[model samples]
Target: MLYFCPASVRVRAASGAALKPIQSINAHPSNCICIKFDPTGKYFATGSADALVSLWDVEELVCVRCFSRLDWPVRTLSFSHDGKMLASASEDHFIDIAEVETGEKLWEVQCDSPTFTVAWHPKRPLLAYACDDKEGKYDNNREAGTVKLFGLPNDS
Candidate 1:
């Protein structure tokens, strides 16, 4: 396979050879800001500065699909424990929960400011995310940043 960085990061094999990705992403110029690999390591997700989330196949090193509903540069990504879903966070004031296989947005969580980080419960469907107050833009009394959990089971 042709090995080149192409302005985007690449996956390097144990032998130090770069396995080329078959994606011609326009976001390469802007570059990816966050990335997450599924539990099985069969696939991975990349969140780009161009506001696109792309899923890549591990075997072929190809981009299988793209999710582009967010309007701002992506900041973070998380794969559900089971690898059935992905949470992509951005400064657009919302987080998108997408189905990994189809790239369909299953749900969204609105925010008061820029959300910079997100993660999933390793043993549950619970999702947690962190956001800033935009330097106390909405509430000067509030902290500079905060983290909240969503989808917590009542039993927990």
Candidate 2:
């Protein structure tokens, strides 16, 4: 997998041996927060404080797509095992799932608290999400959270 550091958005490759730079693309000037790679290692995803997640074609070394208009900085992004969906979460308390090929938005879900993280279930059509939990006026304790379970609709 490859990653871009916060200070330097220069791309580098990391394997079992040593860190070798593959290439560098000026993604964002500052705050290159998070980076994710597709399972097959064909492409990569990058999220920045610029409120944008840019997709790159690793082989071609060109920018593929950019997703912006996020309510806040994009914190995380992940690709499904089959590489059909690209999931993104921001400090906006919402999640956007986009199609890998067409870059079309599959759906968006909202929660009260910001989605800190998300993972696709290993064996089922389910997603696990974690977020901050607020109790009451005197108590503002943060906690791990959950989202609604999504499954194929049943036909009668």
Candidate 3:
């Protein structure tokens, strides 16, 4: 399992009765806000307030790649069910999808409000995200509790 401590990430074994620390790495300069293990369990991703996303190899305990594109802090991350794609949401009004192996940006979508969370479908290339519209700019005078879904393109 993975532990998201402040400014670092720690890996531990869950086999024995007591958890044993395997390795720890400094993931981000600032606080790590979210973490997601890939569906294959061979890798994990960390999102930080420093506006970066890092992919780490589980066995080697080393960072494989780092993605830095957003100016705002990354609020959440989700791996596709097949572990081929990664989706990241930030405090800004956009969501970014990238190729896991090459760190190539696949696509990005702009929303009306700031997105705070993202989740990929378990079996399909569909993504769901929650937005914060506290100023009532998106909704019709109601509180800004909005969840939206989008289908990823096949060619990416």
**Top of the candidates by lDDT:** 3
Model 3: per-residue lDDT, tens digit, 4-75?
666244333343456555556777778888889999988899888889999999888788999998889888
Colliding pairs, model 3: none
In order, the Cα lDDT scores of the candidates are 0.78, 0.72, 0.83
Residue 24 alpha-carbon offset, candidate 1, angstroms: 12
Residue 110 shift from truth in candidate 1, angstroms = 1.0
Deviation from native of the Cα of residue 40 in model 1, angstroms? 1.4
lDDT of 2 by residue, 9-78 (tens): 6566555556666555687765878888777677888888888888888887677898774768888887
Q: Which one wins by lDDT: 1 or 3? A: 3
lDDT by residue (61-134, candidate 1, tens digit) is 78799999999988999999999999998888889999998888788988888899999999999998988875
Best by TM-score: 3
lDDT of 3 at 141: 75
Task: Using lDDT, rank the candidates from best to worst.
Answer: 3, 1, 2
Pairs with steric clashes in candidate 1: none
TM-score of 2: 0.80
RMSD of 2: 3.5
Q: What's the CA RMSD of model 3 in angstroms?
A: 2.7
State the local distance difference test value for candidate 1.
0.78
